[model samples]
Target: MYFTFLGTGAGVPAKLRNTASMVLTMPEYQGDAWMFDCGEATQHQILHTSVKLSKIKKIFITHLHGDHIYGLPGVLGSRSFQGGDDQLTVFGPKGIKDFIEMSLSISSTYLKYPLEIIEIDEDGVIYEDKYFKVSAKELEHGITCYGYRIEEKDQPGTLLVDRLKAEGIMPGPIYREFKEKAAVTLPNGRTLNSSDYIGPDKKGRKIAVLGDTRICQAAVDLAEGVDVLIHESTFSHGMEEKAYDYFHSTSSQAAQTAKAANAAALILTHISSRFQEDDHLLLEEAREIFSPVYLAKDFWTYKID
Candidate 1:
């Protein structure tokens, strides 16, 4: 799995950043990519990267803020023209449905694919399949916002072909039967247990992506033990007062949240345009509290380990 930042700026587009958007690529893990947010000109940003709009199966909106959703109508309409006819589901806060419906209705934009909008009002598992489970929780933001926790299901253990070969078992249809059943009877009347021929199960990775918010416990709950934590750092250190007054967070606050949750790595995004020329200041501040912190730039990609 991996992540591609489409727009890393906050509020408006800057010379180096756009707004707020992210694409989590999970082709090998889940066979498709999922978008975390779709900020202004996000569709335009996708054009500069390897992201495939057709492969975006689901979109999780953090809030109804314009910077986080202005490109939805354009992206949806373009997806249809690009031959993306598969179903696309969107999960967001209440009123997201109205905003999308009204925008599309007013602009006369149409999508050729089926669209599913799920408005969330509580915290719980919002989406689940055999491969992954997605949960959301409310965060302290200017408006009602959410953070998502993506937990991948544990994968089956590796089949020990070397062990079978040691027992004189050659590559044949029996290998297929061995994987499908717990125990299999060989042609020679011998019985084999699949458990004995399988390695330990590999635990799946966890990722937490939080929308714009101040330091809050809900953020900790959603980010606990996550492999990666994507948080907003709209300000620099020593600006905690201003950060809290505006319901945003500083680099130090973001780092504290990651440190508290024991996140393996922290990615800071939604950078304020005020730091347009000094984003390194924010990056440096976060590193003081949490090592391996990254300041997301537009089109930057991060591999999820």
Candidate 2:
């Protein structure tokens, strides 16, 4: 799976940044993209990438702040015009259903596909499929907000084509059986154990995306052992007082959470505009606590293997 940063600025748009939006793309699904937060000008950001608007099947909103959800109606309308016919499921906090419906109604924008809106309130699994499961946990934002954990499902072992060929078992439906079960017997009275020919199944990656909030114990629990922790760091270490006053987290605090969670990497996003021209200090401050801490910029793309 690959994660593409669409926007990284906090609260408002800036000359170099939009707002909070991220795209999770997987190779198994054709052009399928899962968006995290559709902030203002999200549609415009898509124009610069290979991402197709019609392939967006799911959208997860972290909160109701204008910077997080102001672009939903436009994206929905654009998808309809772009010939998207599949059902779309949106998960968010309360008032999302009314907000989307009211906005679409007032704007006279109609969709050509089914739309499912789920209002989340607590920590639990919100979405599940054969490939992955997404869970949410409440955070300490001044208003209600959520942090999401996307855990990819365990996959099957790879088929050993060379071993099959050596055993005179030509490729056919038998390979599928061997991949799924313990063994496959050939017409020659020969039995092949799957474990002897197939490679070990690789563990799936886990990603945690934290929304606007202060440093809290719940955040640490949600991010435990994550491959990547996308947490908001809205202030520098020296601004701890201001961060607490505003119910936001400083760079060090976000790094500490990642360290506590034993995360392999941390991407610090939702940057304040005050240091638009100077992100090095913020990144350095965070790196002091977590060596793999990254400062996300608009349009940044990363692939996790």
Per-candidate TM-score against the hidden true structure: 0.97, 0.97
lDDT string for model 1 (1-305, tens) is: 88999999999899999999999998685459999889889999999999999999999999999999999888888888899999999999999999889988998888989999999999999999998999999999999999999999998888899999998999999888877899988889999888998888889999999999999999999999999999999988999999899899999999999999999999999999999888999999899999889989999999987
Clashing residue pairs, backbone N/CA/C < 3 A, model 1: none
Evaluate model 1: give its TM-score: 0.97
Clash statistics: count for each candidate: 0, 0
- What are the per-residue Cα lDDT tens digits for candidate 2 across 1-305? 78889999988999888888989888776768899999999999988877777889999999999999999889999999999999999999998899999999999999999999999977899999988899999998888899999998878778888988998888889888887778778888878788988888878899999989999998999899999999998899999889888889999999999999999999999999988999778899999888798889988998888
What ranges in model 1 sit over 4 Å off? 29-31
RMSD of each: 1.2, 1.2
- Model 2: ten consecutive residues of lowest lDDT: 24-33
Query: In model 2, where do residues sit more than 4 Å from their true spots?
Result: none
